[model samples]
Each structure stands twice: as structure tokens, then as C-alpha cells.
Target: MQIRLLDLLSRIKRLQEEREILRRNQALELLKTLKKEYEELVEERKKVSQVFTKSRFFKAVELQDLIRLRDSLLEWEKIAEKKLKDGYEELAKIEEELLERHKERRLFERLKEKEMWKQSEEELKRLYRELDELALLIQGQENKR
Candidate 1:
């Protein structure tokens, strides 16, 4: 039963893997998203910094606003890095589970083979016993004749 279930699970997983087209792609996609977000944040910061520069010659903008923007980007970058690391860790765990499933499937297959071999041996022994009995019956009848 486990063998069959494992086989089904593996097939489904393989299909999903094919659809995903390389598990590494997940990580790559994550990196791309993070890069895009970082770039957008940098652009936002640049715009704010530019405003501060322009204000110095014209209106007055607080330096605090620029400082706040830089701090927020730094915080977001740390969070993004953690998420990326977690994503990789999750991938590792999935691979480990797949490996464990393979091991279990192999073990079940070996057990099934052993059981079939035992059944075959018993069947062969029964046939030989039946043949021996027939030979003894014929010999007894010949003596009577």
C-alpha cells in the first residue's frame, strides 16, 4: 500500500516538477523579485535625495526625510535577505523528503520480492510432494499385481 501511495506521490511530484521546470527556478525567481523591489526602493530614495538637493537651492526640506528613507531601505533589504535564505532552506527540506521517500519505496520493493520468492518456494515444494505420493501409489499397485 505504501509502495503504491509513494509511487503516486512521486508521479504527482514529478509532474509538478516538470511544470515548474527546475526547482532552482524558484530561487531564481525569488532573487529577481527581490532585485526588482530593491531597485524600486533605491529609485524612491534617489528621488527623495534629489528633492532634498533641489530644496537646498529653493525651498527647505528636512534632512530627516532622507535619513528615514535610507533606514527603511536597509530594513527592507535585511528582511528580503532572510526570506531568500528561508526559501533555499525550504528547497533543501523538500529534496530530503524526496530522498527519504525513495529509500522507503526501495525497502518495500525488496520486501515484496522476498515474499514472492517465499511463496514460489512453497508452491514448488507442494508439487514435488504430490509427485512423490503418486509414485508411491503406483509402486504399491504393481506389487499387488
Candidate 2:
């Protein structure tokens, strides 16, 4: 019924807020990770370039380290990218759900108003009858109290 719908609406609103917070946290985390990765990549590239400059034949250990750094950087970048995309997707869904909640709230408000108006009309009619009876009683008051 209406109560159930209202409860559901509140739950949905809370969920939407929770999702928004999560999305923001994910975005911030992704940015931090990406920045760290970029800094590391820059430092590694600088070192690798220095090694290449100093000697034509790169040592196996240096080559391996360079490759490993590159691969690790790539993996971190991919993870950040995926997290960013997921954060945006969650935000979009939350927004859509919020819109739906607004629509439901509006519908509920309209229905509530209509019910209130009907009750008021009925009460006014009943009060009018009572007023008429009181007026008649006052007019023929043989013993005014």
C-alpha cells in the first residue's frame, strides 16, 4: 500500500546517497592511484634513460627491472581506469534512481492532497448541519442558561 511505497522510497533515497558517497570515494582513490603511478613512471623512465645514456649494452637486471616497472605501471593505470568507469556508472544509476524516487514522491503527494481535500469537504458538511441545529436551538431558548 501507500505505507509500503513510502518506506521503499526512503530506502531508495538512502541507497542513492550511499552510492553517491561510494562513487566519490572511488573517484578520489582512483585519482590518487593514477597520480602515484604517473610519478613512479616518470622516475623510472628517467633512471632507464640515464642507464641507456651511460652504456650502450643494457644489463639483464636493468632490462628486467625496466620491463617490470613498465608492466606494473600499465596494470595500475588499467585498474584506475576501470575503477573510474565503474564509479561513473554507479553515479549514473544512482541519479536515475533518484529521479524515479522524485516521481514517486510527487505522485504520493498528489494522492495525499486529494484525500485531505475530500476529508475536509466532508467535515465541513457535517459541521454545517451542527451549526444549523445550534442556531435553531438558540432561537427557541425558553430558558436561556
Candidate 3:
């Protein structure tokens, strides 16, 4: 029964480790995606700025259009920033969960080790008692002889 429990605990530990690895990979992928999006936003902002600078002789309607474009770009930048923040928050939550699973697995492992040690001690004591009884029996035979 103890051996079975130990085996089960080990399996649980391995599963926890695998889960952590998967979460870490997911976090990395999310970070990569966020970085790509940020880079794209930066590139787009730069293009908008270049256009605004190069078109100095804009008519009234053209100027209004440029203003609207700038406002839209600003709104998109805000949205991107919010998305990045949310992604980081999600990663943090996953890391916390992984840490908790690791702690639980370690606790089970410690309990298994303690149980094994106790069983070993009991077996050792039983063997010592058997050896003592055999020795006494041999001494009695010798005395009789």
C-alpha cells in the first residue's frame, strides 16, 4: 500500500512539472506575441509621423484627415499598451498557480519519504528481535549439551 502511494505521488509530481513547463511555454509565447505587436505599433507610428512631417502644404480637409489619423493611432497605442499589461497579469497568475502546484507536490514527496523511512526502521527492529531469539535458543542448546 505504501509502495503504491509512493508511485502515485511520483506520478503526480511528474505531472505537476509537466504542467509548469507548459505554462512557462505559454507565457513565453504570449510575451513574444506582445513584443511583435508593440514593434508593429512603433513602426506604424513612425510612418504616420513621417507622413505628417513630409506633407507640410496640406489643405484644410487634408489637415483634418491627418488629425483624425493621428487620433486613431493614439487610440490604437493605448489599446496595445492595455493588451500588454493584461498579458503580463495573466502570466503572473499562471506562475502563481504553478508555484502552488509545486509546493503541493513537494509536500506529498516528503510524506512518502517519511513513510518509507518509518517502514525501514520497523523492519530493522523486527530483524534484530529475530536474531536475538535465535541466539538465545543456541545458548540454551549449548547449556543442555
lDDT of each: 0.68, 0.68, 0.84
Give the Cα error of residue 10 in candidate 3, in Å.
Answer: 4.1
Q: Highest lDDT, which number?
A: 3
* Per-model TM-score on C-alpha atoms: 0.57, 0.56, 0.86
Cα deviation at 104, candidate 2, in Å, is 1.3
| Residue pairs of candidate 3 with colliding backbone atoms | none
lDDT for 13 (candidate 1): 56
Cα deviation in Å at residue 96, candidate 2?
1.2
Query: Scored by Cα lDDT, where does model 1 land?
Result: 0.68
Which model is ahead, 1 or 3, in terms of TM-score?
Answer: 3
Q: lDDT at 18 for candidate 3?
A: 79
Candidate closest to the true structure, highest TM-score: 3
Pairs with steric clashes in candidate 1: none
TM-score of predicted structure 1: 0.57
The alpha-carbon deviation from the true structure for residue 41 of candidate 1, after best TM-score superposition, in angstroms, is: 6.0
What is the Å distance of residue 129 in model 2 from its true position? 3.3
- The predictions' CA RMSDs to the true structure, in order, are 6.0, 5.2, 1.9
Q: Which stretches of candidate 1 lie over 4 Å from their true place?
A: 1-66
